[model samples]
Target chain A: MSSLKKSFNVRCRDFIHAGEASISVQQLLKQMHIDPVLIRRIAICGYEGEMNVVMHGGDGIYCVEINTDRIVLDISDKGPGIADIAKAMEKGFSTASDEYREMGFGAGMGLPNMKKNADEMIVESEPGCGTRVRMSFIIKQSTPT
Target chain B: MVPEYISFVEKFCTGCSQCVRVCPTKTIRIRNNKAVFFDELCIGCGECTRVCPEGAVSSSISVIEPCMKDKLNVVIVSPVLYAQFPGVMPSDVLIGLNEMGFDHAIDLSYYLEMFQYAVDEFVLENRKSNNAPWPLISPICPVVIRLIVLNYPNLLDHILPLRRPVSLLGDEIREKLSHEHGVDKKDIIIYHITPCHAKVVPDRSGLMDELGFIDRALGINRIYPGLKQKLEQVKELELSLFPNEHFSFVPSTRGPLWGMSGGEIAGMRIDNVIAVSGVKETMAYLEKIEMGLFSDMEYIEFRACTEGCLGGPLTAVDRYMAKSTVQKFIKMFGIGRRLPRHKIRQLYDKGWFFSRIKPSELAGVYKSKRKPLTFDDMKKIEKLMSLIHGSDCGACGAPDCKTFAEDVVTEAADLKACFKMKE
Candidate 1:
């Protein structure tokens, strides 16, 4: 029933500081002694989400919530939102510019990769306003009674 | 239980906390003016042994001296041994060991070549099938194996299945001597001239110990003096008398280089392989790999030692000098020997080199006895963290303030231990 929450700031177009949030989250999960497979899955989703925010969104917030039974990641960005979520979810459908593409930033696999690794994923966006993504992973019962 | 390979001399320890700072696993703590090690948390990287200026940290030496008097002792010299003597060829070192009363001295390079062939074929097949994990990690360094077992269990499958060349050579030597020479298996003792203490762990733990080929591990520094004396005498002998062709074991151009960092990947035929050395570097790279990065890499060779085995804590010579000597030997002994492809293929089919490591075997090694933290525990830790100054001074015996806060909350340490609290 008890849950812990932490948040990290992600700056748009900040290639240098990208992935820092996910790395911190990964380290925290390791310290909590979570199952390595679960940690890796969460790490992949966190990384993909952070990269998405850096490339597509304006300034954003990456947050994590942890409890005995599950972990949830909420990433929200204030930028021009996607007009068609379904098309954006398709593979190889990157809207990244040539500059970002050359740097290997956007291959259009970000949302799909996150979805693949997370047990559940939800996306909400208003084209003129902003976007938010939520991902959750179920933690197996590991703590002794 | 794994044997205690590293020892702390209480008299020599100044409690300066250098070892605690250098320990990759944070297994050491300065308690009561001496360094104490938690056996379970130790990955045996020997970083403390290198950093302890007081010579407080020392690896356990060979116990085979008394037992070897009656046995047919055969020494298996690590390639790092040959690099220790700047001018002496590996054959001379073998001869020197013979003079030092060993029945036979075998160079590990022969088995290193065999290991390379097997790995090459295995990589090729795995590439074609794409069934196994990509970027298979080298299993040569026991410390690296232990690190994966403790910290990165998810990457356990990334370790190559082949038995380490030393283990393979130990088995082959024991079998050959007992079967062909008619020596009793119990009487034929195998002493590994080890460059590091980590090599001592595998002989006692995991799948590497199932065969029980190696009887003991002798540090290079321990045996250097006697070998050097014999080498001085052997150096005077005519080069033509013990020519390269006359020696039973001669390494190929690439085999001896295996003791150097990046040497393993250098010999591999694959193009997408990477080689990383040093504990910190390996750990950082592993973090990246766990994040699902480097998908295109076919292989990765990681050595816990900075300059590979030559820079091991037990070595007597400077790592840079040893590296140069290894290079000189390779140049002198240009392209010496090769295992026939057919022979390697046959052994590969028989699964002769495969060694499986089960992560389940290492289950409790890294586990904490305390129960998982609850919401209240987290809130308490966060509050304590805010109260403490964030300077990571090791005066509290913990690695950093964050660890100190966790320890205090877990009842592992007292809040009074924080020197800053008194001020």
Candidate 2:
């Protein structure tokens, strides 16, 4: 048809099946026959945001929205907010544990890759409050096969 | 070896994505919520069958059952096929093949005598040219040929310039039947009673430029028992197993040994020869041979199995028991007492297994046949490529850049593990 919107509330601290939830979200958008480019954008941002919640967030939720017009993903965590969101967003500046590093989780490129791949990206975090990240993607109808 | 077309049943597919995940060529697409197979790029390895959880993957092997119309079906069995019948006499199996729609059933080693002459001539030419490498690998084994072509392609030029044994034998049979029986060439089906599945992988998947070689494969393991059962109903004519054909190629007491280690070099009189039968040992030899580690050798034979075809997993015999039996047969037949002069010399004139290389052709489906990638499609493909790490580690099982990118674009694979950034 035209455009559709889909949202998902990704549990903040679920580590075991973290990627599984995003996979379903990605597959659902794919089944909807959304534009390949838009689905990719949604997927890249959605996965990064979902992973960021599980890896870096305190206790909050992440949401994903998809449609024919554009796709949007929003994630908020009430963890120790990034005192320096700029530093956190830097490609290699990571605050991750050895376990995260062993699991290939904390290269600090999550925010960067999200920004690089998505058409729009926004992040807001308070020092004591929480962090909320929203990203958007343009529906390049034929972005992928 | 040519592949028979396998029907793609979309409805029966569970969308479990096993085929997509295991296909060596990455030719499957998950489009419109179903897994669609693209035959153009398929190598026909049946990797999809091993991966399918639903057991939905099936081959069109039954397509060869028609016996090539009312025409005479002459089947040539490799000597090692003796291992297929276990305790049964080879003549009994020959009778079985005769009952199984075969007008003529002959052992391939008979034709091999002639085939050996061609290889000898090819080696002579190789030495004269001095441009080719020593110890020219045998093309008799299609799997070894494919491995060289696909993996060790640099050694392609060194392969012996002779038509494969079966193809040569096919040509000779065609000519004789055409002249002797005055049979129209089209009315004859020359089937090589085979053991390995490579015989089933067609000479050309339309992946090559030339016409495909051979008509069909009848793996002895697949059809021999059925024929054996059918032989029970036939008139009990104790037909001669060893036909009145003139003897020329009397190999060692180890006739089936030709299917095993030391079979090729020892039997063919290619002195300074070394042969490895099984896969592991052959690969190890190839490594050194390709690297020029071995020298002063006239020929090298690699069978991809220990003790060669006698020890083939498809063979129904204990290895040592079969070897001893073949030894006994050789001693009883007085095979080692004398050598048969090579009487069949016309094999040198036969043409090679002809096929041209394919480069980024997508099995020749160009813009004329299939639509060209649109700019939008290109951008999408690039987007998917970006999803991949570009390392091209073959983790997703697609070999290189374009293939992996294509898979991602087709939605046959997800982009997460490939490009997901750690938090």
Candidate 3:
């Protein structure tokens, strides 16, 4: 309901401090009195894409924008692009290194989780170039808890 | 304590880890590429502020800048802190504190011994009244009280009626200092050495629009540097190791533990008195309340952090170490149960001590915190939370994205606290 929008920038693919960005977006959605279901979706997808950038892309920037009617997320990477977009979307599929898997990430659930939470998700990648992800969730006016 | 009190400077803040290393509670956090204070975790020990060479970190103070006009400052420290020195007499800290700026210092816990009975009575009366809110929560901790007021308004009535430490002591300080000494209320400002910032913030806010009885709240971390420095330099007077000032004062490990987690509930020896040890545990219990579950408990001691006041952000020692310190101190001097009720009554009957100093303030449930969240609003919040998945991962600048979102919706918080919502 406020005219002003609250915002922050997430550094590309910094695994050590990865989730910090998604947490902020979830809090912003909460301030808008948006539904938890909506927040949860945004979080799942945001986290998914965020991890993807870290593991696959090396380093990338992520951005989130929230409004009463809808929530938008944009994750951009300057690292190597996705070799194959279709192969990456498969459930339980990951190209993450051994280090990433050891940290409980890169079990191939990242893309799936993002797809599950967001109402709309788009991924574009060019080999040797970076990859970008944009996701959106539509907010319902009233939902019973 | 006066020179050692916590002071904050917004400028000259460089993200340095010096203060964090020196902190006893580890309450200082570097979230969102900057320092974020975990209030529930801070004990007002003045350690971090003292260690901050740049003086960028600040805590609430009685006097503001440009007018560091020193006055006849008095302090009222809680009893638990008396456990700090194992060998010294309480008078040593008192004498040392007096030399600092207090000019006069008195123990507020002396009044608390009598008030415990009052608390017991208050709980008993509420238990007998079926109309009272079920699982009546204790109101002794100012931090918990304010947490409820700022975030959980629906459960406001559930708060038990008890005098806060500083408020009760505030009345006594005002009376003893101004009335007895022919000093004006404005002139005789009493600073309460807060265990955490919870007390420090509201005390500065004048809390609930009520005039603050205690002039300022000095945290342990904020004062640690100044006091430690003073102690090092002022070798002239051997710092007294005795913690309890009076022979009547019982400040053994058990006595000090009275303020720790589950201490009050255990003290009451009442049935259904639940003591939530940490924020996560407390939130779970609060969740039980949200499920429409009628908590039939009589007294609940809700601690925001893992260790009780001992784990406060301000203290100069680690909680486990402090607990061990307290344990060793208790073993050295056996002080088990509270002083006899009669003795407490006698102290109360006589003017030598009084308990309820005008019962000035009460902490609210939901809307009382710096940023507030409510039970009814959570449904809307859950909707938002459901969108994010249940991972409370603090990627958001806030402790969690969902909570940050709730705070923002209520206009109690900013979107900057969250990563998911960051632009």
Alpha carbon lDDT of each predicted model: 0.80, 0.57, 0.57
Q: Give the DockQ-based CAPRI class for model 2.
A: incorrect
- Kindly indicate the candidate among 1 and 2 with the higher lDDT: 1
RMSD of each: 2.7, 15.6, 14.4
Candidate 1 chain A: 10-residue stretch with minimal lDDT: A136-145
| Candidate with the larger TM-score of 1 and 3 | 1
Model 1 - which docking category?
medium
* lDDT by residue for model 3 (B271-305), tens: 67777766556655553443223355676788765
Chain B, candidate 2: TM? 0.66
Candidate 1, after superposition: displacement of residue B195 in Å? 1.1
Which stretch of 10 consecutive residues in model 1 chain B shows the poorest summed lDDT?
A: B238-247
lDDT of 1 at B258: 84
Q: Tens digit of lDDT per residue, candidate 1, span A1-145?
A: 6788999999998988888888888877777778889999998898888888898899999999987788999999998999999998898888999998898667888888988999999999989788999999998887412
User: Candidates' TM-scores?
Assistant: 0.93, 0.53, 0.54
Off by over 4 Å in 3: A1-145, B1-71, B203-211, B225-255, B292-294, B335-423
lDDT at residue A39 of model 2 (Cα atoms): 49
**Overall local distance difference test of candidate 2:** 0.57
Q: DockQ for all models, in order?
A: 0.57, 0.01, 0.02
Tell me candidate 2's fraction of native contacts, as a decimal between 0 and 1.
Answer: 0.00
Cα distance off (Å), candidate 1, residue B379: 2.5
